[model samples]
Target: MRYIHTIKPLGNRRLLAGSCMLILLPLFFLCFTQTARAGKDPNILFNGCQVLFQGEKPYIDQNNCTQVPADFAADYLGAVISQDTSQKTISITKGDTGIILWTEEKKALVNGREVSPDSGAVNRNGTVMVPLRLVCETLGSGVEWVAETKTIRVTLDNGYILPESTCLSIIAPPPGNPDKIGLSILLFLDRDLDKQYDDIHFIMTGIFDTIQADEIVKHIGQKKTPKDNLPYRKWVRDDRAVTAGSEPGDSSISIIIWETGG
Candidate 1:
């Protein structure tokens, strides 16, 4: 089984229903961490999708909905979109071949018993498979696929990670230099909470004692926010050793100090 198809731009149900009434709507959890081998290559992470395969069967293409034998040779490493419409159609055919292939308006069960997707089938490489804990519990999110060293963990609910000692080491005032003593540079992080303002990096360093001895590194990269809010930029150094750079993983920095001349 191998699959890799890319398509972007499909999430704007009135801006996610007005940003789900001003945020705080995240409750989907799935944690899977196992690996050994012999069970075959299996490693998947959801809601931040990471599905690596072997003897594969993980379908989802209810007539172009996407994710089925699309030149399968997989490695998506990214995906997050819990409820954008919920038409429902999860699959993993073969050996414990789980099936919730509901198309007539959605409704398929497993532990509740109601199987009839051609019943009991297992065929790796020749297609026909299932299991990855039944397509992450039928796409609700919470599936761990580990086959003796193969790891797959799908945990979603607006997943987040903004802990670099809670970054924030700012010191602005450089657009025109009021006293030429405005140092410190920048380092910030607000990570998608839309408040109107955005700045990710710009620092060079002159050692304001390592900009007051560290504290500027953040994360929380994908929750999708764009109505206006994600601001945190305060870096203005006119020489003293400041050379910062970001946008390559490990981001979530916040440092804004604008209140001088007292």
Candidate 2:
């Protein structure tokens, strides 16, 4: 036997419309949330291509500036970063350039002088995030911001090149390791020698710019056997090293000499 049943119709159209609205509202909200997140892409480009960070990826802060991990500048940009939680400050050193930033402060200390930047350093997720453009530029890198694609193009300015007979020297604390933490100078002779240069006596003088490396040497040369000058010792001797080089392997006979600096 076959049975036929009559379909029941809604008496109140408003109730049926209300039920539909409840279901559709949630779906609309989900779509809107997903689209908002998809539109926000923070990408950092080295030169013109994307460079991946080992652990943390750089993000765009509220100021719409790229903020990268502290280690990224240290490892890739050859910058030395130090943090003092008590002071809420972050210090970065590269070559003869040094900058100190306070969290949420718009001003930065460029080589001990205060200057305001577009964006300041911020603390996020226990990691200090620095303004990418200001820090990278201070580290001798050129940065271009593409607003249409939300990209930060960083072209690391090939470091200063030394004269043919000159040596690229670095004097500071050891980086990437902590066991050795005294004063040391690594001198890279621009020209190769059959053997190491022995008894290389040189006086130390500090300069504000890497381009002044040769000038500093000339200035010190004029000094007739100047007293042991360690101008940077008064500053924090932490894992901060000064360097001046465009690229590695361009020089021969790289010698690292350790000094007790007693």
Against the true structure, candidate 1 reaches a TM-score of 0.20
Candidate 2 weakest lDDT stretch, 10 residues: 14-23
lDDT of each: 0.29, 0.45
Q: What is the lDDT of candidate 2?
A: 0.45
Candidate 2, residues 1-262, lDDT tens digits: the string is: 1111111221211100001111111111111111123325466655333555544456655455566766656644655667777999888775456777899877677776566666688786676777777776666566665556655566545432212122223223323223333223333342222111221222222213333334434332332222323222122122323322122333322222222232
TM-scores of all candidate predictions against the true structure: 0.20, 0.45
The number of the candidate with the highest TM-score is: 2
Over the stretch 55-153, how does candidate 1's per-residue lDDT look in tens digits? Answer: 343442222111222112111211122221254333322112233334333233443345433212233354433333334333333444445545444
Q: What's the C-alpha lDDT at position 247 in model 2?
A: 28
